[model samples]
Target: QLGIVTATRDDGFVVRTLNPGGSPLYSVSELPLKLARKCLDVFGTASYDEESSIHSLNTGYDDEVSSIYGAREFCLLRTTSGKVLYCGKPSALGLKQGGNAGSRWQELIVAKAPKIAQVAAGHEGLHAVLVGDDGSVYFTGTARRGEDGD
Candidate 1:
């Protein structure tokens, strides 16, 4: 599918599809001006810089948890207070088993990790790496199984 991803001046993000042979499945002009601005804002200024200070960042998805579910995608966001926010396509976040269907980003009430420097999400959106200011690394989510299946 032909799609165009763009960030708007209003701090929002949009995804539009373009038809191969037609003007577009939907016209750009007809597209909604506000799409996922709130979601995009969750990541605003949420990055961690080890050189500056120890900040926490939430990485999306946990493969270990997703494996139990249906391998749904999720977004993770960390706050200044070390609170991790989660949202996405999954209905439950591993522990709980039902919600608004991941329609909006929500904070993980039980997750709190302070003094975090950086967080990196895995390409599969199943795991994340947390780097502490002291250069310590922490891994979360599912682990890659070895040939022995240990």
Candidate 2:
């Protein structure tokens, strides 16, 4: 299967696709000129010389975006404000809001921790783990809570 990676920049975002052999398929910036100006404005003239903080937007299958067996793929996004969003096929046990024909990005609600630092989804895209800045971990998706019979 193919793999896709999305990274956030000071200005905008970047997306890259890879072939089954892991070779580069194509790379594109969400917005080039606007991103450049945004970077400059935030970091000043030294922005060019400085490194932009990059985060690897991972899929439910860990680092890879798409599944090799043709299962539905899901992408995770973390905003600057620490909000986590999900985009892809809907899971029966996952949050069910914010999905439409044109967009699938949905806000994942963590009762224990509203602010998330990172998140990882299962290969089946049915379960996920979230880590908060305070070092607390939370679980969501199709997994049943507690024992089977409670």
Q: lDDT of each prediction vs. the true structure? A: 0.47, 0.46
Instruction: Tell me the alpha-carbon RMSD of every candidate.
Output: 14.8, 16.7
Per-residue alpha-carbon lDDT of candidate 2 for residues 1-150, written as tens digits (9 for 90 to 100): 343545566544544443455345443323323344221122212111122445332333222122111113344556555676655544533556433311234555677685677766666655666679899887665655441123
Clashes of 2: 0
Q: Name the 10 consecutive residues with the lowest summed lDDT in model 1.
A: 63-72
- Candidate 1, 27-146: lDDT as tens digits: 443244565322221222211211233333323433112111112255555555444556554332343555443434455544344555566776565665665656766655555653
Candidate 2: segments with Cα more than 4 A from true spot:
1-34, 37-73, 96-102, 112-114, 144-150
Per-candidate TM-scores read 0.37, 0.41
